[model samples]
Target chain A: MGGADIERLIALLARLPGLGPRSARRAALALLRQPQTRMLPLAQAMEQAARTVRTCSTCGNLDTHDPCGICTDSARDRGLVCVVETVGDLWALERAGVHRGVYQVLGGTLSALSGTGPDDLNLAPLLARLEEGGVREVILALGATVEGAATAHWLQDRLAGFDVPVSRVGQGVPMGGGALDVLDDGTLAAALTARKIYS
Target chain B: MGGADIERLIALLARLPGLGPRSARRAALALLRQPQTRMLPLAQAMEQAARTVRTCSTCGNLDTHDPCGICTDSARDRGLVCVVETVGDLWALERAGVHRGVYQVLGGTLSALSGTGPDDLNLAPLLARLEEGGVREVILALGATVEGAATAHWLQDRLAGFDVPVSRVGQGVPMGGGALDVLDDGTLAAALTARKIYS
Candidate 1:
């Protein structure tokens, strides 16, 4: 029936995380054998999501509506804004359900290796929006990579004297446990170098 | 834009392979932020594939057509049939590019725990198909699990006194491996007991 079609399906699935050609082939076959009732709804969902989902014009977050629900919401604190390198990071913060403010997705961090810079980031617009909307605090929630650190520094410099309290998210290993085995050698070294004596 | 939509998107993406709520949330955010050209086409492809794909009536493979391409192919060796528990397994064999025979999908192995049996499987239909066709051999490409072994034995008993030869796929760990170092005592013992002298 759909030899070429199945091939196409496998190709698409292979692109997803943790799916190699072997697993993709397997998943496709399972889908093929499934009844229409099961398959159709999934298909519809995929179509609907694809057709309607769009980015928030204000903060570069994904949404079906402009400005997004968070931005439009009155309950959230308008003065506190979290800045992240990607929309994915924003979603993670959202799922944690801890933050009460809106977000600014920078699209990506400044990377010297990748030729990414301050201007390349959509930060100017975010800054402008902050100024226009009277934002008080900007929380940088970027990855703990070199690029991320560089970006945080860049943003700090850019927003200097703007009357906004710029704070970077905590870096290094987790706390309140035994020795941090998960912390990288560099972070561990840094932590050791900046260690404080207990009373 | 997609504040409420984030929940729905996360749920949907979590259902996909290798994506937990954490990963799904990230993916949704990524999609929301950029909505790039790559994303639109990928989404469209996903939708189109989902909309058209269906099960093959003759062989239980997924396809846009009813009989499926494999079943309809005149060039394939229909007499040498490979029996598999799932369409996914069949696809794995196809990916290996080793076999040129048609396939018989058992749907699942017999499991007393799950209350699955010969009747629960498509065995009757398979037997009928065998009777109606020119099948000379049935290759069991089932898993190495206990149920998979029992199913093979059951099939052997059912096809007693038949002319066709029943064979199983070879059992062993994949290449670039040594279980003697990593396997538990029981599995290592079993592997050693079942070891064959390869020339």
Candidate 2:
């Protein structure tokens, strides 16, 4: 705390997610020990990101590009867009390699109790993107919670005349998971009812 | 993983103490959401610290000044000094508000197995500070562990010719810790032998 600049840096770092006062001290000390390797580079990166980063105009994902990398990637499937609740979810789906289509981040879900409505989300931009044509299907990859479901249902009602098919990700026991002993009864029951023929 | 700048920021942040890839994403999002309040300020703080913070030439604690604030404080006991193994230890002591004396960090301890020796530590500077005179007592406030004991012993031996009353902080059962039933035999025995009068 003796150095004003160091103390300021530690205090600022403490506000970052996952770091508290004690850990911020450790991080500050660590950064100080490797000024060239960690401190300078991290400061430069943060400044650069803060200066340039913007939300993707099409999908509401945080990126340096207005349209975002995924929205502009020519190789990605433009006819199928996956809708999600947040940028974290978009990143999760990207990390999983489960879908090749571009994504749409809702920013948040409709929470009736909390007074969040359709306009509160990034839904208008998504609709505008869809209206531009070429998209054939919309995948609702929202969470399985009440808010997520309500958002999906509302979006479905709004896009009723869009002439594009929309579907929620299928619900069942998770793949490579949900061993009978580990699964809850509702999941087990759903998986059993949705049982399909073996290929 | 979309925008190069955002991705690079996340990656660098992940390298910080207490942060991994997942938390880095969360931090990035948080910073992005409050660019003016958090991101720009934090980046500026880090840059300022990187440029100005330096090890105090007199005591080894980090500060912008050569002699450090603790060394310059007139009310603190100039004749008494607390010795520790690292800056974190110094901070811990400062936080406790127990000592009115200044501090000297050893930087590290002697370790035969790790090939660390006396010259590798901040011992020379400490000796020089003592040679400047008026260090009546040197408190070895290192840990009770073997490495701490070894460092303390080495310092005590080196300071024998100074005619200063060197002392290790008395240790036994920690306050509010190691209840009689919970304490190990070695701690219980030490606590018993070191017990003082009720007066």
**Which candidate gets the maximum lDDT versus the true structure?**
2
Q: Compared with the true structure, what per-residue lDDT tens digits does model 2 show for residues A64-135?
A: 888988888898998999999988899888888898988889888999898988778888776886899888
RMSD (Å) per prediction: 3.3, 2.9
Candidate 1: tens digits of C-alpha lDDT, residues B42-94: 45555566667766666766677777788888999988888888777776677
Best by DockQ: 2
For candidate 1, the docking band is acceptable
**Best candidate, TM-score-wise?**
2
**B1-199: candidate 2 lDDT, tens digit per residue:** 5678888988998998899999999998899878878898998888888788888888888888778888888999978889988888888888888889988888888889888899888877668868889888999999877788898888889999988899989878888894589888877877888899998
TM-score of 2: 0.89
Residue B12 in candidate 1, Cα distance off native in Å: 1.9
Q: Score chain A of each prediction against the true chain A by TM-score and list the results.
A: 0.88, 0.86
- What lDDT tens digits, residue by residue, belong to model 1 across residues A1-199? 2566667766765765556776666555545455254334445454566667766787877777777788889999878889998766776788679799988889898887889877788776577866786888999898878898888998899888687889988655556646778667988876777677999
Enumerate the chain B TM-scores of all models: 0.84, 0.88
For every prediction, compared with the true complex, DockQ reads 0.43, 0.71
Error of 2 at B174 (Å): 3.6
Runs in model 2 lying further than 4 Å from the true structure: A112-115, A171-199, B176-199
